[model samples]
Target: MAKELQKLFEDLKREMKQEFRELKESFERELRKDVRDIKASMSFINQCYEEMKASVKKVEAENEALKESISTLKEEREALYAQVKEQESRLMQNEQHSRCLNVEIKGVPR
Candidate 1:
């Protein structure tokens, strides 16, 4: 009877060890799957970040170009304004000279 009891204990120990090994294997597999999912998510986020950076760079370049164009237009406008001012001055001088040249005959009475 004692021998039989010892035999039974040994069998039970073997079975417990087998069950523990299986549980450990299942847990490891689940952990590995979670890690893979996390890696994939990180990869997608990195891709989006890179694309956004590129778009921002493009916008910055366009903005710089617009600034240059505005600066050039302002300079042209200033030059045109100067020309107009000169023309106005010439017109006023011409009118004054013409008035000076006008003569009323001494014998003419109004």
Candidate 2:
């Protein structure tokens, strides 16, 4: 009877060991799947970051080009303003000379 009891206990221990090994294997598989998912997510985030960096560069280039265009336009406007002022001065001088000439002609008496 003692031998039978010992054999029964040994069988129970072996069964429990087998069950523990199966549980450990299942846990390892789950952990590996989770790690793979995290890696994939990290890769996707890196890709997004690269795309955003490129987009920012493109926008900055466009902004610089726009600033240059605005500067050129401002220079052209200043030149036009200067030309207009010069023409106004010349017209005023011509008008004054014409008035002086008219007065001289009248005084001379044709």
User: In lDDT terms, how accurate is model 2?
Assistant: 0.96
**After aligning candidate 2 to the native by TM-score, how far in Å is the CA of 19 from where it should be?**
1.7
Candidate 1: worst-modelled 10 consecutive residues by lDDT: 101-110
Q: Please identify model 1 stretches exceeding 4 Å from their true place.
A: 104-110
List lDDT for all candidates, in order.
0.96, 0.96
True-vs-predicted CA distance for residue 2, candidate 2, Å: 3.4
TM-score of each: 0.78, 0.79
The number of clashing residue pairs in each candidate reads 0, 0
